[model samples]
Target: MIIGKVIGNVWATRKEESLNGMKLMVVRRLDTESGCEQESFVAVDCVGAGIGERVLVTTGSSARMALDNPNKPVDATIVGIIDEVEVRAEG
Candidate 1:
């Protein structure tokens, strides 16, 4: 899973039939250790994550499994909304 932050939303009036009711969100990948932001991408929102919230994202075939459909044409999916993150520094 990749750690990211919800930056915005995606609204597509017409989409694949299998994705009719799925909520889409824009997420920017975050460097958990340095707190730096990276590339932003679209993801299917499985949890009720909103803008500015930290989230857990699953990509590739695993993302399809999260939605219980392997043919949904989704490459990324938000699986959880993170309340907090604790990173330990290496010695």
Candidate 2:
């Protein structure tokens, strides 16, 4: 699982049967404290996350497992919406 922020959204009128009702959003990783956005990627919204919200993401095989059918073709999926994050610094 990866901690990320939903930076934007994706719209597609036509798609595969397995992905017909899935919502797609763009996610960018952020620095724990500063919230500085990093690399961005598109992910299928399985948990109804909106833009500007921190989200938990699952990738690869784990991503498929989050969906109804594990065999579906999906690379990334939003697993949860984060309410808060606590960061601990190492001295």
Candidate 3:
């Protein structure tokens, strides 16, 4: 799982057949401790997450499970809309 912020939306007129009714959003991974920005990627959103909201993203095969479709061609999906996040760092 990755902690990220929803940055924007993605609309595609043509895509894989399995992704016909899915809502895709742009997510920017965030460093929990330093609050730094990391890689950004498009994710399938099924939890009704909105822009500027923190969300939990699952990638790879697990993303397919998040969509409840084992064969969906999704690489990333939003599993949850994060309510809050707290992290502990050790140096």
lDDT of 3 at 41: 99
Clashing pairs in 1: none
Q: Write the per-residue lDDT of candidate 2 for residues 54-78, one digit (tens) a residue.
A: 9999998889988888887899999
Clashes of 1: 0
RMSD of each: 1.2, 1.6, 1.4
CA lDDT of 34 in candidate 3? 80
By lDDT, is 2 or 3 better?
3
Worst lDDT window (10 residues) for model 3? 82-91
TM-score of each: 0.92, 0.87, 0.91
Report the poorest 10 consecutive residues by lDDT, candidate 1: 82-91
TM-score of 3: 0.91
Ranking by TM-score: 1, 3, 2
lDDT of 2 at 5: 90
For model 3, the superposed segments whose C-alpha errors exceed 4 Å read 89-91
Which scores better on lDDT, 1 or 2? 1
Decide which is better by lDDT, 1 or 3.
1
Pick out the ten consecutive residues of candidate 2 with the lowest summed lDDT: 82-91
